[model samples]
Target: MAGLSTPKQKISALIITYNEMGYIEKCIDSVSFADEIIVVDSYSKDGTYEYLMNHPKVKVIQNPFENFTAQKSFTLKQASNDWILFLDADEVVSKALQMEIVETINNPNACEAYWFYRKFMFKNSTLNFSGWQTDKNHRLFRKSKAQFTDRKIVHETLEVDGKSCILKEKLTHYCYKNYEDYKGKMLRYGQLKAKEDFYKEKHFNYVLMLIKPLWKFFNHYILRLGILDGKKGVTICYLNALGVLERYRELKRLEKKNELAYYLVMP
Candidate 1:
């Protein structure tokens, strides 16, 4: 009894969604290897909930939409197990990744959290370089050591207090449906980012707004060797630059509104 290792630990695969009918099935199927699957839907009107209603292994809960960090944190609390594997609706865990995840949780080492490399695919092409080549996310973690940061609205950070590990297998990300879809998401993300910064009392500087976007394009495309990935690489860099521009524009708009309100009240 003293020499034996601890028993295999079960994992709870957690996903948060809102009107993700198209991608939900594939996402869930990828993580079927997990002991339990918990989906916290934000009242999806597009039949996303109905599809998961009869699943035996899945436990679905309908909750209202909140910020990204809050929604994810709430889902973490609903998990029945200590281990959590968070997945976005549009992403798919490969078979190799599934096996690796099973192995890691079954006999976890000293690490309390693990990071996975994400491979982004657009259309039929997978961009291997475009500054996204090094994209790794902290998805698998022990619930006791991990929590989401509340400071940001768009991209939330997972704070893990213990040692971490990285797996070589990748999680396939079907990020954008089309160029239009990509632009739409960028616009929304930019606005949310601007609001997040504005609420933090970050002042919007006119000079930095113009310089930052241009520098972003140059740094990602030229300095990061994104130029080698060809057309998709260029597109990715350009869109990233555009997102920076939009964020500053939105921030300026909010500042102007507040200034006008102050003047009106003073007179």
Candidate 2:
């Protein structure tokens, strides 16, 4: 028999986008159940603007992309309801998760934030391991109790004031479609992280550059049980390790360039 009907609750689904023409429609469709959906676009040159502007169910706010944390924080303030559900342009909300979110928002159970398990997809296959299996992110939270940190240029994290609980359902992440896309994103993220480390005066050591990648591979593939995922797992591990190595390499390049050199008087 079907379970009792879940109580309705007002939820605002917030999405940040930039040139995500391919993924925007599906992402929006998955959260049609939400009370309101707001898209904080970063002024895309592509047709993303045209498509989103036409969607009746979505409200688009074009803003310049400064950083991940700031863009997300701005999106949160646009939400009308106290309950906010944050989603990326390439992520989809499963049917079970939608129901679970509704129920949780209606009946808080003494929690201010809720986390969702994520299953990443690669080459059209659901990657069950390679450190991706255990991935979880805090996406749902009460606006009053949650805040985002601006410490890093990328990989920003959320801080919730009260207790948090994890939901049973999972969210689907379409992280990369092909090798080119993966490589491009890796390079871009590596550069951003390198800049962050450089600005923060983090040490640039040759030994760390060599060993850290190896550690990342072993930690994710061996300790985290990523080997069980086969070729897909190896590929994920390799990319992760490569990302770390490249960051240090980029950091070293920046260090030698010397930011203060621009102000020096040349002979």
Candidate 3:
């Protein structure tokens, strides 16, 4: 008698996008190995939604703009498969990663969630340091076992209910195209972080505003060995430090506005 063959495990690739016209096509193509590709777009005006809508392999859903965690949570709910491979619009999964994902999900003893390390790219150059060397996130997982945390606004965190393992293959993240793009992204992240802090009732410290950025620069440029990456390293480290300062500044602004509102209500 012939041995019985196990059924192949189906994987759903989930992506959230907002005006990512330039990178959406390539990102979707890279994840073509997935059984289904679900894209939840935030009403993209840059033609990202239209392209994904027309693509036969993609299932596109349009949602209103919200915080990162909320948007991702909405996307997760649309997946038909138990195994989820969450990807960003600017990120690409290599062939090695595709094979590894397939093999891991097929294994009976595989963990509930898997962390994927990333290779950060700035323009055409691959950044080896500047605190990005150890970049990783839990992108592949069993949907029933994981959900994103509710508090974080900018850098969303996944809360896994079961065991997790890190994958060997890396995802390539085309992070920033130019200086202006990088600046805008960092500033927006800072603003969102400030809103999170405000809701958490966290007090802003002037000392932190002054000292944290300096420490950030030192930590990235020196302690993290960003110096080895040359001028690109310096630029990235400096901008990152500025982003920290911007977060505190925005937080302070929120606090001041709140105080003004309270005084206005006082007769």
Candidate 4:
């Protein structure tokens, strides 16, 4: 239901990827209409490199693995155009969104950036009523005018200093391949968040750990009507809640070690 400006300017699509073999073809094919395609890969161990090497419109660059925010900032810097759309390997350009993007690029008036809603896909299902429905990300923008603020480690957000517009089309996102990958990602992301919070002196409480997971489940499943998606909703909610639990557990360990053991036990 969001509205703003019409598409009227040329766009350069940019992506920072790693081990995207399963999804790269679709990602590239979806954005073929872009004026330029720039991919900064994090030395993928998979066949992603071979695929891009054969792609005619794509320009690939090699980079060592870095955190999401830093890698994206570096990728944008490598892109050789002004207007850029930041996309992920597992994300697909929907037909409606593609049309809107073409139109927007052809006739951009007063907006420098555009935000789009994501339709996250779990296996073969899309949860419409989950908290994910409110998940809108700033993806398309004038590269020179947008930058990421260094506030977050896991869900790094961007800060833009220009007029913006909201596109109605949803971007298709394949979040995880299976349950195993989901759990592994949760553990890794929890470690990242815990480290960041540790530096900021964010203390942890047992009650907060227990309550936060429950709140996440309630927020995603009940409040967001994830119940509409049936089993998919349940899986998403449960995994997300578990991830939150892991984050708090890791944070607590950090606090205990740094605050209590380091000064007293170690010394």
Best by lDDT: 3
lDDT of each: 0.87, 0.87, 0.92, 0.83
- Scored against the true structure, residue 246 in model 1 reaches a CA lDDT of 92
Tens-place lDDT per residue, model 2, 66-154, is 77888998899899998899999989998888888888888836489998899898867888877776789998999999989878778
Q: For candidate 1, write residues 1-267 as lDDT tens digits.
A: 579877888999999988787688889999898989999999988999999888777899988876788899999999989989999988899999998888888774647999989998876578777677888998999999999999877788899998889987999988756797688777877888888989998878999799998998999899988898788878888888899999999999988998999999995
Per-prediction TM-score, please? 0.91, 0.90, 0.96, 0.88
TM-score of 3: 0.96
Worst 10 residues of 4 by lDDT: 102-111
1-267, model 4: which lDDT tens digit per residue? 889765446678998778888788888999998889999888888989878978999999988865777788778888777878889888899778899887776772748888988989886677676688789899888877889877776677888898878998989998867898777777777777887788787888889888999999999899988888898888888888888898898998887777776678764
Residue 7 alpha-carbon offset, candidate 4, angstroms: 14
- Ordered from best to worst TM-score, the candidate numbers read 3, 1, 2, 4
Off by over 4 Å in 1: 1-5, 108-110, 261-267
How much is 36 displaced in model 3, in angstroms? 1.1
RMSD of each: 2.3, 3.7, 1.3, 5.0
In terms of lDDT, model 1 sits at 0.87
> Which stretches of model 3 miss by more than 4 angstroms?
none
